[model samples]
Target: MPDGAPADTVTQLRRDLAAAYRLIAHFGMDDGIYTHISARLPDGPGGEKRFLLNPYGLRFDEVTAANLVTVDETGAVVDDPYGAGVNAAGFTIHSAVHMARHDAVCVLHTHTVAGVAVSSIKEGLLPLNQWSAQFFNRIAFHDYEGIALNLEERERIVADLGEKQVMLLRNHGTLLLGRSVAEAVKLALNLERSCKAQVAALGMGQTPIVLPDDVAEHTAGQYQKMYDKMEGAGGKDPEWDAFLRMLETAAPGYKG
Candidate 1:
């Protein structure tokens, strides 16, 4: 039942994967175990592609790596029972990205309150400040497609994603992709914060400091360069790590 991973090989990673679920809970993101966060495990020596996911129907706090489902790139449940259980619906979103982006090691999606708010904003993400500047010229929006269960939607999603790393599924949620777990984790959290900022700015009816088009492009390039330096080496972000620990304390049984 260990999915072919040596017994000890999967333990630490299971904890890390579980921590991701717990962190999602800490951030007030999770729709009764509906949304998801997933990571592509490097292919084993056998040449099969494997990934980790929170099993279906389990509340975010109830997730544990040991219970994480291991699946193939095609969204097939190649591995036996793991995680809480696999949701076939997850293939709607995560499978597309996993199959489309070979470098997309970790993909995080959310349906948080602010995230959905920004997704519906007609003006979209404005360059209100440096925190959002990275997204100024980089966010892509996909029009609402009721429930995204269509396999064909994968092509449309990938088309919308293009070279951008952050996306908003209109009337749905936000998505972030990165080649490493740390990078992907930070990207999603940052995207959520950006959306939260946009919602707050709009609520006050304040004139947001939208950078000129040229300025937005320049700033995005600068931020991209800064991240490029730290790239895969993007270490464990202390904030996310601490958040995971906090979840452990608040929901002590989550890492079970």
Candidate 2:
């Protein structure tokens, strides 16, 4: 298990992260071998920060627990049994959040057509539906500055993200963070659906109905309350458990 981290902890983290990759693929959110889902590992020896990321060129469905690569904050491969290094752009985007936000244990980024469509829109993610209302006033936006290979852009990414858990990489895609793999998956799924709905609504060529600011804020508060209750109840997220069960039947062997 990578020096300072407990064996059981790392094992579970690998399985969880692998499952996230498979789920993203199953939901059609994956963009071939691009984009990424990363989980911050427990600090290694000497307080070195590390993360588990899918190897570059591996489709999400192929990300087995045993195959995921471990990398340091500098994006260097620390433990890559398959000898598959990570994508440089993925590292730049994920590492920025991992370094800046201690609360973001799992960082998920996607390039769905609907997500990019919404990102391209001037209004961004409007509260056009109940699902979209959950993100009202909570999502951040980062202007695109070409591909994210340049290390210097990390500072701007962090600054734009600020303290928000969800972000729209304008004209690029969607990004979100969660305290765990399950939470990240949940947020990504919801955000994708919200974007899809917005695109469909706007395509009708009619003025879409948007919730009032107060109502939208209230709905967002309600969602937060539900999340807080789940956290208070020992973090036993039943929805995440159900998703795991679905994954077991639909796409097994991710835990391998």
Candidate 3:
């Protein structure tokens, strides 16, 4: 079930998770099916916490509801109809947040060009524009320790992320945590756009004026309020709904 709720929850989760994959692919965020977006399965086998993950070897655009598999906390497959199994390295980051932050229902990671470019920069994301201002004091940075494959790295990531909603995997990519798939998806989109804008602005060979601390903090606070309102109101996102409709035309059959 989506977020591991129960019964129909699985069906809805399957559809929404699949839709998320298609949407990521639609936005050119997916990197040859390498990155992952995981959701906690509340009704996992043995009453233990489990998660829904995309089976390895499948492109994001090829992900369908029926192809998603269930995995335990250790990246072991709890259930697999296709026998495609799981991605140990990819799950390392997701499992860390899932285990440490119970409030995070969805963990989305991406290896987009802009995301990786920004991650490699030392200054990280500058509060240059309104989009960038939204992340002021709301993002974390974790030093990359090579490819994430060990449990210790997971613990470090969790520690660095703390309570922030977004994180930049230094010299790597980006990580987003959300209480719902819609929230996570929206955050990822905004972060990507922010990075993309930063990179474009830098190309102009002129340092963009940074927002003052007071203005940046106030703008970020306003955005946080809107997010709180969305989360409180059942996490409904009109953008997600519009994306699903677009998926039906651009990449149909994700719901299957």
Clashing pairs counted in every model: 5, 0, 6
CA lDDT, candidate 1, residue 65: 66
Using TM-score, give the best candidate's number. Answer: 2
Count steric clashes of candidate 2. Answer: 0
Ranked candidates, highest lDDT first: 2, 3, 1
Q: Each candidate: what lDDT?
A: 0.77, 0.91, 0.88
Question: What are the per-residue Cα lDDT tens digits for candidate 2 across 67-126?
Answer: 999999988999997787988667899999999998887999999999999999888999
TM-score of 2: 0.96
- Per-residue lDDT value at 61 in model 2: 94
- Which 10 consecutive positions of candidate 1 have the poorest summed lDDT? 1-10
Q: Write the per-residue lDDT of candidate 3 for residues 145-196, one digit (tens) a residue.
A: 8988777888788889998989999999999988778789989999999999
Superposed by TM-score, candidate 3 places the C-alpha of residue 225 at a distance from the truth, in angstroms, of: 1.3
* Model 1 Cα RMSD, 1 decimal: 3.5
